[model samples]
Target: MQPATTAVIALHYQNEVLHPDGKIRVGLDSDSPVRQNVLDAASAMFQRARACGLPIVHVRIAFRPDYADLLTNMPIMRGVAASNAMTEGSWGAQFHEQLAPDTGSPREFIVKHTRINAFFGSPLEEVLRIVDAKRLLIAGVATHSVVEGTVRHAADAGYEVLVAAPACASASPVTHQAALDSMSLMAQILDANALAQFFDELPS
Candidate 1:
């Protein structure tokens, strides 16, 4: 629970995923309370982590303008291709304004991933290593996708992982809760207040 031993990874907080105007919003419930809760919780967690000096890693999913890195053959990715979602350097690919890192902050790290699992083809692990992170505090859009995928991988990689429940959302509440249930087997699940308490109790 020590701040120094932990890094907060905010995943896919991009305009493409979280904003109402996002390209993928067509496939998501733009008015879902679950989604809003996740956004609010994640924002609060980011603020708390910054105040506590915890390393913050922002993980986003993006691809080349031509989407050469994307698997267009996959059904999910096919939709992405049709919508041109999360194209690198596009407005939709940028992190949501509220959760974006200050460009001048050396402590904030941004990892752009092209895959579902943040670690699959990204510098996430390397950045965590640079911060001496032994545990990861994770939150993001699509609880059933990136959140679940990353939690399983992180657990197998031997990092202590905690999922801030309210900070994760999915297109459906059923899927969201289901993913949370399944991920609990591998990661500790906490709400935002409890996560904040973990930081507050850290030894000074």
Candidate 2:
């Protein structure tokens, strides 16, 4: 039998505040935009994936209510601590509306903790196995962190990896491209539109 079809994995995309310094501070501050270019690509990718009947999974990064573990581990959580940032009930931790609808009402979402990689402490692999997903189409923020981490882990896990080049961003354009280049050998880098086209052409 043919290998299982692709499943789209969108990572660490929260409804967040875009700081003037370009870091996402994570909250419903005035810095928030209803949408951004990267999110636009993700929305389009989701629609295309659903239309093609491909499985869709969204991964979010969040912390526990007390944040006791993250504070003990990363400590950066304290430096950036806001009541909203990374907290489950806050607007900052919520999924962007566009991606939210696709992940809910039918599809399921997997949540991760402080780890940059989605699979590090999450049941993402189990979910993929449940769906028999073969390939992953990835998109998200802070290309140097969550995106980079997931790409490396997914490759090591033997999953076919595809990065949506335009559907991701980092603190800067230079770092973004650098991460892409570093992972290029390990991943098939493609634009979101190209990924959509590939799924559209999948044999039924």
Candidate 3:
């Protein structure tokens, strides 16, 4: 894909989600290889995209301390408030260093979302329009949640979606594989290295 028509969306690469010391890491069963060094894979993908002049949009999930902005309709959503996991302005909610955006950069956009699907109630679509991007490369933590959610939405909305499987994972290897299998129907599944090779083939 050409740089001008493609963009990368980095999702939930936050301390509360990706870090070992994250508050939400307690009892999380992410021992799978998919979760290991996952951020490094994503970071390298970002570097390649940047080198190709592809814009990146960083999406985060956070809420007010009072949970005023959060809708607790499920166990996971309730857990966030109960554990104070994704409180806005908290250290846990901050983006992880490996994939954090370079703020003030013209091509990087930071959007805060309150839903599983990044586009729902978020400025993601508007950001894509701003960048004139119709194809997306997505990498995020909890492959079954935010990644699958966003991929499904983007596919249905007529966007060309590619999921970097190596850069994504869920709480379990089983869950992560299942999600990737399901997403393969709607999106192209590529590893970070393959994606880099594809990007390199683009004409200068």
Candidate 4:
């Protein structure tokens, strides 16, 4: 995709989800290497995307300290509230160190969201519009949840979408693979090498 019309969005790469010490570690650390691997893999692509002048938007999920902003409508949502996870101003709600949002970069933006779909309750869609993005590169901590959710929304919204598969992880291999397979029908799924190479080859 052309750099001028493309953007990269890294979602939920937060301490609450991706860090080994995260409150809601999706899976046993040993059984899910993708959790950590995805950070390095996605970071590489983000660096290239930055160097190529493509806008980078970091999306995070957080709620009020009293959990006032969260709607515990489902079991998972209730779990988040019960665990007091991703509370605002807490380290657990912060982005992962490797893919931290750059506040000083003009083309970089941070969109705080509270729903499974990043675009549902956030300015992510408007950020893409502001950046004049026609194509999007997406990477999220959980492949089966946020990644898949956002991909479907982006597709339905008419933006060309690309998912960096290596940057996506889930509670298990089965879920991860299944999500990728399902997302492939709606968005282009790119392996780590291909994603890295795509960013590296982008025109500055």
Best by the TM-score measure: 4
TM-scores, all candidates, are: 0.92, 0.82, 0.92, 0.94
Tens digits of lDDT, candidate 3, 44-162: 87888878788899999999989999998988898888988899899999998878898867889899999889999999998898888899999888889899999999999999999
Q: Which has the better lDDT: candidate 2, or candidate 4?
A: 4
* Comparison by TM-score, 1 against 2, better one: 1
TM-score of 1: 0.92
Assess the local accuracy of residue 59 in candidate 4 as a C-alpha lDDT between 0 and 100: 94
The local distance difference test score of each candidate is 0.83, 0.71, 0.85, 0.86
Model 3 residue runs over 4 Å out of place are 1-3, 26-36
In candidate 4, what are the lDDT values of residues 3-34, reduced to their tens digit?
Answer: 35888988898888988888887664834666
Candidates ranked, most accurate by TM-score first: 4, 3, 1, 2
> How many angstroms is residue 58 displaced in model 3 relative to the true structure, after the best TM-score fit?
0.3
- Candidate 4 regions exceeding 4 Å error are 1-3, 30-32
Worst 10 residues of 1 by lDDT: 25-34
Q: Tens digit of lDDT per residue, candidate 1, span 48-78? A: 7877788899988888998888976667788
Candidate 2, 67-166: lDDT as tens digits: 6646444554564455336676767677766667443434445656577688987888988887788788887876778889999999999999999887
Model 4 TM-score (2 dp): 0.94
